[model samples]
Target: MTTDQPVRAAVAAPGGPRPPQDGPDRGRGGPDRPERDGPPAEGPPAEEARRGFLAKAFGVTALLSAAGSVLGLLRDLLLARYFGANQGTDAFLVAWTVPETAAPLLIEDAMAFLLVPAFSLALVLREERPTGPDPVRQLVRATLPWLMLVLAACSVIAVVGAPHLVRLLAPGLADPQLAVTCTRITAFTILPFGVAGYLTSALRAHHRYTAPAAIYVAYNLGILALLLTCHAVWGVRSAALGVAFGSLLMAGVLVVPFVRGLRATRRPRRPCGPAGDSLVLIPLAILPVAAFTLTRQAQVFVERYLGSGLPPGAISHLNYAAKVSQLAMTAAILIVLVTFPVVARALAAGDLTAARDRVEKDLGQATALVLMGTAFLMACAPSVVALLFERGAFGPHDTAVTAAVIRVYGLGLPAQALIGVMVRPYFSIRPVVRRADDPAATGRTTLLDWYPVGAMALGLLVTVAVGVAATPRLGALGLAAGNAAGITAAAALLMRGLLLRGIALRLPRVLGGQARLLAAGVGAAALGVPAAAVTADPLLSTLLGGTAVILAFAALGTALGAPEVRGPVLGLLRALCPPSPPAAEGKLPHGR
Candidate 1:
C-alpha cells in the first residue's frame, strides 16, 4: 500500500482527516483505494498530525512571508542605491512590466483563480469514484502539456517583439533600445512562471504550505544575488536577468514536492470513458479570470504611458511609489490567501453557510489590517521613503516626490484589498451542472462571465481620463490620485456584481463596519500627521507617527464599536494582565 492511500481515504468525506472534502462521495471500496466508513486508519495519530500542521501553518507562512517582503524591499533598496532612479531605471521598469503583470497572472491572480477551484472540484470527484481514473492526476496530465506549449510560445513572441512591446508600453522613452533588451531577457519568465503557479495551486489544495509560501523568499534571494554579483558588469540589464533567474528558482523549488505527490497515486484505474470530458472547467473558466487579471494589471500600463509623456524620471518615481504602497495591500491579503482554499473546499462540499461565514470574517480581518497599514503608511510616507531610499542615488528630491505619490496611492489600499478578498467568492462557489457519465452527479461546469472584465475596463478608462486631466498639473501625485479613484470605483462595482450573483453577504453590516473603520482611519491620520511633523528626523518621525496612528486608531475604533480593532486590543489586554476577580466583590479599597 502506498503512503497516501490511507490519508486519501480519510479525506474522502466531510469532517474526515486532511481537513475533509465531503460526505456524498465517501464510501467507495476498491483494491487500489480503501473504503473509509469511519476514522482514518491511524486515527488520533492522523488527527494530531493534521492538527499540528494547521496550528503552525499560519505562523510559519507568516514568517516566511515577512522574510520575502523584507527581502523584496531590500531588493528595491539595492536598485535605488546602485542604479538610482533615472532614465535608465525607467527603461528597465518599462521592461519590468513584463514580470510585474506576468507574476499576478501566472502566480497569483489568474492561475490561482482558475486552478484552485478546479483542483478542489477534482478532489471531490476523486472521492466519489475511487475505481475511476484518478481525477487529480488526470487534471494535471490534461492541462500541463497544453499550458507549457502556450506559455513557451508566448515567451518566444515576447522576445521577438520586445521593441514593439516597449514602444506600446512607453512611446516617449528616452532609451528604447535598452528597454527592448531588458524585455527580451525578462520574457523568459513566462514559462517558469506558469509552471510555478500550477504547482502552487495543486500543492495548496492538498494542504502543503511550506514550499509555496517560501517561493517569494526564493524569488527575492535569486534577484538579490544575481543583481549584486553582476551589476558591475551588466548594469541595469542585470536586474532584468535577475527577474528571469528568480522565476526559475520559483518553479524549481516546487517540482520535487509536486512529482512526489503525483507519484503517490500508484496505479491508475482502467478507462472511465468520457470521464475526462467532465473536467472542462479548467479550459473554459480561464478566459474571464485571465481577462480580469490582464485588465487589472493594465493599471501599470496606464501609469507608465502617462509618465512616459512627462519628464525622464517620472516612470521610475511611479514604479518606486507603487511597489512601496502595495506592501500594505500585500500584507493584509495574506490572511485571505490562507483562507481561500478553505472557502473553496467548503463550497465544494455544498456548504454555503460555512463559505459565507468564512468570507465575512475574512473581510473584517482584511479591512482592519489594511486600514491600520494605510494609516501608518500614509502618515509616515515622507519619513518611510526617506529612511528606505533617501541615501544612495535616490536623493531628498526623489524621496519627496515618491513620498507624495505613495501617500496618494495609499488611498486605494482599502479598495485593492476589497477586490482581492471579494474575488475569492466568485471563483469558489461556481454554479454546477450534471456530469455526462453520472446522471445524478453534482459537478461544476465552466461558465464565463465578462462582468469582471467589464468592470475593470471601466475603471481603467476612469484612471486614464483622470490622469490626463491632472498630469499637466499635479504630476505623479495626480496619477496616484487617479489610481485611487479608479480602484475605489471598481471595488464598488464588484460589490454590486457580487450581490447580484446571489452570495448572501450582509451588505448593511459590511458597509456599516467599513464606515466605522473609515472614521477611525481619519482620526488616526489626523493625529499621525502632526506626530510626524513634530520631528525632522526620518526615524523619529516614523516611530512617533506610527505609534500615534496605532493608538488613535485603536482608541477611536473601540469607541466607535469597530469589532476588528476592539477585538484584538481587548484580547491583548486580557492576555497581558487579566482582570482581578471582579475587584474582590466590592472589597477593592486598596487604591481608593
Candidate 2:
C-alpha cells in the first residue's frame, strides 16, 4: 500500500491521471513503471494552461457569449409563443428598441472598444517590468468619477425626456399613446445599461470578462422566465417588467465583480495634481464618446420610423430578420473582439508589424467564414427561415416575409462582417492619435471620433432609399436590398481607409477551395429551387428542399478540399450520429 501511494499521487496530478491499473496493463504496473521513458502526464494540460493572454481572455468571452446567445434564443422563443407578429408585439419591439440599441452603444461595444485596449496596455507594461508601477490604476481612478457623473446626468436627462424620445423613436406613428408608452418603458432601460456599461468595462479591463458576461446570460434567462410567467398571469406589461428586471439584475451582477476586480489591482498613481482635478477632465473626453453612442441610436430610430409606416407586423419581421443576420455576423467576427485589445496595445507600443499580422490573420479567417455563411444562406434562405422560425405564431405569411428579408440581408453578409474587422483596427489607430496630440489640445481626431457615423449614415440613407423604392413594389425584399447596399458601401469605405493607411490585406489562397464551395452551393441550389417551386405546400417544400440542398452542398463541400466545411460538418456528424465500436487493427504490442 505504501509503494502504491506514489502512483496514486502521480495519477491525481493535473493532466489525465495515470492509466488505470485495472486495465490490461495491470500486470505492468510495477515499481519500475514506464514513467521514466514516457512523457509526463501533466505536459499537455500545462501547455494548455500556458496559453497566451488573449486566448485565455477570449476563451472566457466566447463561452459567455455562447451562453448569452442561447439564453437570448430561449427568451425570443418564449416571446414568440406569447406574442406572434402582431400589433402588441410590434409595440413591444419598438419600446425595447432603445435599450436594445443602447446595449451595443453603452455596454458591450463602447466598453469593449475603449477599456480592453487600455487594460491590455496596462498588462503589457506590467509584463515588461513586473515590479514597476501600473499606469491603469491612475487611468481608472481618473476615469471613474467622470463615468459616474456622465451616466448620472444621462439618466436624469433620459427619464425627463423619455416622452419626446418615444415620439422620435416612431415619428411616423399617428397614435400619441403608442409613442408615449414606448418612451416611458424604454427610459428604465437607459440607467441599467448605463450602470452595467461602466461596471462591465472595469470587469473586462481586469481580464475578468467571462464571469461578468455570464451575468448577461443569467439576465436573459431571468427575463425569459419572468416574461413567460407574467404573460400567462398579466400579459404584455409583464414582458416590459421582465426587461426592466433583467437590466437591474445585470447591473447588480456586474457591479459586485467589477468592484472586486478594482480592489484586487493597486490604485493608479496621481503624481502631478489632485485626483479630483483629473476627474473633471474625464467627462470632457466622455462627452464625445456619448455623442458617438447617441448618433448610432439615432440611426436605429430611423429604421423604426420607416418600419412603423408598414403593416402592423412589419417591424417585428424586420427585427427578427436583423437578429438572424446579426447572429451569423457575430459568430464570424467573435474572435475580433477578443483580439481587439491585444491589437490596440501592440499599436500603442509602436509594434505596428505585429498588429498588422494579427489583424490580417483574424480578418482572413473572418472573411472566409463570412463568405461561406453567405453562400449557405443564399442557397438555403427559404428553408433555413422555415426550419428555425416557422412554428408558434410564425405562420406562412410571416415565414415568407422574414425569409425575403433574410435573403436580402444575406447578400451583404461578407460586407457586414468586414465592417467589424475594418473598424476595430481603426480603434487601435485612434488611440495613437489621441496620445500624440497636445496634452492640453483636444485629444482625438474628428475623423477617428465619427468614423462609424459615416458608415451608419450611408447605411441609413441606403435603408431609406430601399424602403421608398422597394416598398411600393417588392415589399420586404426592398428593405433587405437597401440593407445590403448600405453594408456594401460601408465595406467599401472601410477598405478605402485601410488602403489609405497602407495596410495591405493579402487575400488567402483559398480560391480553389472557394470555387469548389460555390460550385457545390450552386448545384445544391439548382436541385432545391425546383423542388421548392413545384411543391404545392410552400412551407413544407421550403423547409424540406432547403435542408436537402444545404446537406447536399455540405456533403459535396466536405468531400472536396473545402477546409471550411469540415469543421462544422465533423462536429454535427459526431454529435448527432456517433460511430459504432471499431474493429481492432492489430494485437497490442505485448500480444495477448
Candidate 3:
C-alpha cells in the first residue's frame, strides 16, 4: 500500500508480512471506513497538505508567542530594574518553580499528552464511521468526572504537602517565616493548574487547539503585569500572588469554553458501556501520565536545590537562562502540541504505516524548525539576554551567568527535538498484527493502544536522576547534559518498546540520515565557533558567523540527503519571496 492509501487492513499476511491492500474505495462500507482525503488522495499531495496544516499551526503559534515574548521582555526589564536579580528574585524563583514546573507536568503532560491524544483517537475512530453515536462525545462525557476528581485530589495534596515540598526542594529556605509564607502561597494556587489542565484538555479534544494553546500567552502576560504593577507595591509577596492570579485567570478562561462544549455534547448519539460511564477507567491511566509529568517537575526541584546553594541571585539567573531555552522555538513546540493528537489518533487506529509517515513528516519539520532557532539563539545569546533583561536589576554579572547557561543548553537543542519525536511511540496505536513468529493469526490484527505510561514513568525517573547527578557535578552546563541524557534514554526506551513488540525500526536507514544531519551540524559549528572567537563585538560576530554556519549546514545536509535539514530551509525561502506570475521556461512572466 502507498502512503496515499487511507484505509489500512488490520489483518497481516503470514509471518508478519503486509497484505496487499488497495486505496479508500476498496474499504468502503467495511469495518474501517476511510476518512475524506482533504484534497487529492495521492501520497505527495497528501504530504503537501500535511505540511500546509503544520505551517498554519506554526504561524498561529508564532504570532501568539511573539506577542507574549515582547510582553515578558518588558516585564523582566521592569523586574530587573526594581528587583535586580537579588534576594527578592531568588525568593520569587524558588516560589515560582513549584508552579512553573506545572507548565510541563499539569499542562503539557496531563492535558496534552494523555487527554488530547485520547480525545483525538476517539474522533478518528468515529470519523471513519460518523453515522453512529460519536465516540468523541462519549469519551468527553466519561472523561469529566475523573478530571474533576483528580483536580480535587491534587489540590488537597498540594495544600497539605506544600511546606514539606518547599523544604525538600529548597533546603536553603532555613528561615521558617519566609519558607512558610512562600509555601502557603504556592500551595494555595496549585489547584488552578489541575483545573486549567482538564479544561485545556477538553478544548484540545474538541479541535479548538489554538485557543487553549494561546491561553498560555495570556497567562504569561498576566504574570508580567503582576510583576510590573505589584512588585513595587507588594514586593515579592505580590509577585507570588501574581502567579497565583495568573494561574487562576488561565483556569477561568480554559473552563468557560470547555463548559460550553460540555453542555453542547451532554448527550451522546450513541451511549457507551459501563466502562465509559465514568472517567474512572480513563483516569486510572493518569497515574503513569502524572508520573511522566512529575519527573519533569523533579528537574526543577533539583534546580531549586542546587540553586539555593548558589549566591543570592543565582537561582534567578538559572531560572532566566532556563526560560531562554524553554521559550526559544516555543512556537514550534506548540505546533508539535497541535499535531500530536492528530497523529496519535492515526496511530491508535491500527495504522502503523500511517503513524510512521506522520511521525516522519512532523519530526522532520520540527527538526528543521528547531535547528534554525538553535543556530539563531547560539549566535545571539548574549545580545538577546542583554537587550531583553539587562536594564532591570539584571546587571553584567547576571547577564553573564544567564548567557553562559543559555549557550550550554543550546548544545542540546537537536537532542530535545529528537526526544520530542521519540516520545510519540509511547502513545502509539499500532496493531499487534500476527507476530512474526506466529502463523495461525494470519490475516488477523488486534488494535493495541499501548499508552506506554510505565515506560514514560520510568523515563521521567531516569531523566530526573540523571539531571540531578549531572547538574551538581557540571553546574548549569551539567543540567543540560542531564536533560540530553534523560530525554535520549527515554526516547530510546520508547522506540525499543516498539521493537520489542515486533515493529521493525529499519535502523540502518534512520542512522544513515541522522549521520548526515549531524555532520552538517558539526561542519557549521566548526567554522562558526572560530569566527565567533576572533570577532570583537559578540552580537555582530554572531550574526556574521551564524549566517555562514547555517548556509554551510543547509548546503551540506541537503547534498547529503537530510530531509530534516532541507525541507524547512526551502519553505522559509519561499515564505520570504513575494508571489509571482507563473514562469514560462525559466524566466519569470512578470514582476520579478
Number of the top lDDT candidate: 1
Please state the error at residue 116 of candidate 1 in Å: 0.4
Error at 224, model 3, angstroms = 1.8
Candidate 3 worst ten-residue window by lDDT: 8-17
**Candidate 2, 27-134: lDDT as tens digits:** 231111221111111245432432344455566777778888878877776766677787777777777876777787678666556665555544444333333233
Q: What is the lDDT of residue 361 in candidate 2?
A: 58
Best by TM-score: 1
lDDT agreement of model 2 with the native = 0.60
Each model's RMSD to truth, in Å?
7.1, 12.1, 8.7
Cα error of candidate 2 at position 229, Å: 1.9
List candidate 1 stretches off by more than 4 Å. 1-55, 265-278, 431-448, 580-592
Clash counts for all predictions: 1, 2, 8
Q: Indicate whether candidate 2 or candidate 3 has the larger TM-score.
A: 3
Give per-model TM-scores.
Answer: 0.87, 0.75, 0.78
- Cα deviation of 81 in candidate 3 (Å)? 3.5
Query: How many steric overlaps does candidate 3 have?
Result: 8
Q: What is the C-alpha lDDT profile of model 3 across 466-491, one tens digit per residue?
A: 66677666666566555555555555
For model 1, the run of ten residues with the poorest summed lDDT: 4-13
